[model samples]
Target: MDLSFDCIVAGSGHAGSCAALSAIDAGCKRVLVIEKGPPEWVGGNGYFTAGAHRTVHGGLQDLLPIVRNATAEVASTTDMDPYSAEEFTADIMRLGNNQSDPTIVRAVVDGSRDAIGWLAERVHIPFIFSFHRQAYLVNGRHKFWGGMVLSVEDGGKGLIAAHQQALEKAGVTVWYDTPAVELKLDHGHISGVVVIRNGERLQLSAPAVVLACGGFESSVDLRAKYLGSDWERAKVRGTPYNTGDGLSLAHSIGGQLAGDFAHCHSTCWDANAPADRGDRVLSNQFTKSGYPLGLMLNTQGRRFVDEGQDFRNYTYAKFGREILRQPGGYAFQVWDARASGWLRMEEYGDDVVDKVSAASVTELAEKLQAKGLEDADAFIETVAAYNRTVTAFDEEHPSVKWDPAVKDGLSTQSTRESLKLPKSNWALPLDKPPFLAVKVACGITFTFGGLAIDPDTAAVISEKTGQAIPGLFCAGELVGGVFYGNYPGGSGLTAGAVFGRKAGRGAARVMRS
Candidate 1:
């Protein structure tokens, strides 16, 4: 069977959704989005995110002015100190170990802010301003899954329900549960896609195709092959459907892949442990009480890293690899009453005390049965040693500072000012009593590496010559080399918007030409 449209977008995650919407906005009369799985409530990882976004124009100077100017209305001041383009680029280069494509990185940074603004105007996505000065910060207040949610919002069905009221009103055709199985290429140009609908396969012809399928985080075999042995053992916290369909599709068509070697964010605790599957208790407790404070110790009971650093930094992957050397890649986080008090407030809140009880250090250790350490005495001793070291350092150093700005430092300033323990008190010690310990397992949200694309328009590029694959484009995690190593707070969503728009607009241009 065969069908034809102006454009066909594969996958229904944030990137695909944005590509469809942007295509429609760019004046494409016929656009069809293909999603493989059933529509789900959570809507993939976008719903689980803390929702931060950024942009620092470095190499894409020609387009920087357009994006910067377009994003002016939604740009918010941040308390988090900003890194200059050079600093940002340097940080990315260092993180990527110089493996990333400089042109792709520049395009992402240059188009970021404007993409946020575009999504807000098009979908009524709400954003909050950050108090930090150095960084670009914004709040995503769209209902459940809007804004970034629009990209993969159940494969654009949700967007079709709300904002796409305008699209339908404007005559956009959407096909549900249609999975793109093959790319229809003719004479080195993408002509369409072969899709399976209701188990019936059909060819959907189009002038251009956008492969917006998500990354390969869900495929354990692929994770082992591309990510390494460590990712093979890592727990996944996001969608199980993102199995690199886009990457596979692009590769089959001779599209180049980039950033296939980097990862962002690390899990200190696997809240998805089988024993705790249905219980939000673990997450609730940790987020409120802050049980994972102070120095984190592996099974052998020794400090491995500075516990205060943001977990999002891929550096945690190094710690994860180290901990996996233990019995099960598991570790214990020890803290006292004061730390517990803060953890309760920060992680679980006061109400969790009623659910899980441990009045003393020994009792807490007994409850958790922490590996390596025998009982609460061992846990208490570790806490004492940590406190002693903290005190000695405090007296000797007098002042503590982070080289680059810390995100969310300002919103948390009131808590810091009240503690009066120094700026590094953000790096607080576990000095108090009746301590707590919880076993943490490392988990990954999604893989960062994917297909390489043209930095100028996000069109999929050939691996041989680094030239664009005509009639093909990509965005979000499916297109790599954009996010160096560490993902700027909200780049995932922002990237989808920015590159999705560019890919859509560029595809429209190809069709018109």
Candidate 2:
């Protein structure tokens, strides 16, 4: 096999795919992609994602041309509000607690719209309106609640297939089960990568190396060391291959680390999910993000978080951390017939979770007790208190209407007769018969900390000199400082494409210069 290449990309996931394709577009004839897993485990975490891509668009009209599901009839029924650049940036800054790296965030925001267009036109990703996940049919219209909208037709699997088609058409080569073990440096510049190819340690020559390998969320030891004491036990929501190989390779060559090492983009996952890996058939269906329309009770049988604090898109990522903090590292989401019908079937379907249901709230608590709930009486009392509070609030504001498509001020927060905890939006009494409940646990998506890089060029920065490391580029979950505490939903995929494209162009520039 030829060991020489103009550019080498580590990991064949979404970010690496974009990097490789961008390099080819930038006139690089010899571009290689290396994967740590076998051909069956091809796309890494990108294969397990929802394939949601958050970007700026001029509402339904601007996105109509790109999305396959947006027919004329569908467009008439869809009421999607335009998402602006400012709104997108504000979301990240706000959710991340204003700690996102400004330069990196700005570049991703500025490049987001174009990246979406490229994914549709160049990569041929079958984009569709995220109707099931982000929209609710209200008043005979599909009203999109959050700023996020588009997703791949069949989610991440489809996204990977699309990238593979693009890569094959571009004549790019991908090597499976060939993990990049180390980086070779020559005169303070990146030379190539050392890889365990065919059980032999081989050194491949390249002027530019793009590291899109992902985070340390897979390594139990690394998870405990970086994310905290409890993170080692957090359920792995994606690929087991993201064991921080690229992080180690970059660290060996003085790559600086930035972002939150103690935090990650986690979510409320299925309590029965496997501890260390994701189910290939289930994928992101394990996510239980329907808490906004209901209440979550810990073992103590009391509401822990404001379930309706914000749109699920803004709050779902960090809520997993809260779940891990609860007693026995678990919680139960309770909903009645009034709100249970709103939960997405993909996530809460009978086939997806062990659904526990009862004809009344008291019986629901008893059924939940058999499924590991601690205080059945407390669960019942919690329901009674919540219903009473909602009833009182309704009496005060009789004209208020409960709408799921927006933060319609229907809430449990009141100066009088309110519980200690509040449901900030979409609050309705759990008096409707046939209550339902599901056990949930923390699912770690990706670690937030990673290599520091130049926002403009996607070039890795050195810890030694605090300057850009020549021929070294980073993107995807392995590129940090774009997020801190929490992240806006769908921003991760968008940032990957933006920085991946930038890294690809930057890689080609290294050869020319």
Best by TM-score: 2
Clashes of each: 31, 0
Question: What TM-score number comes out for model 1?
Answer: 0.76
Give a tens-digit lDDT track for model 1, residues 227-300.
66666666554556677788878889899877745564444543334321112223212221132244466654
lDDT of 2 at 40: 88
- Tell me model 2's lDDT, rounded to 2 decimals: 0.93
List the candidates' TM-scores in order: 0.76, 0.99
Tens-digit lDDT string for candidate 2 (449-492):
99999999999999999999999999999998998889989999
> Any runs in candidate 1 off by more than 4 Å, and if so which?
56-91, 130-172, 262-265, 273-293, 309-326, 340-360, 370-380, 398-425
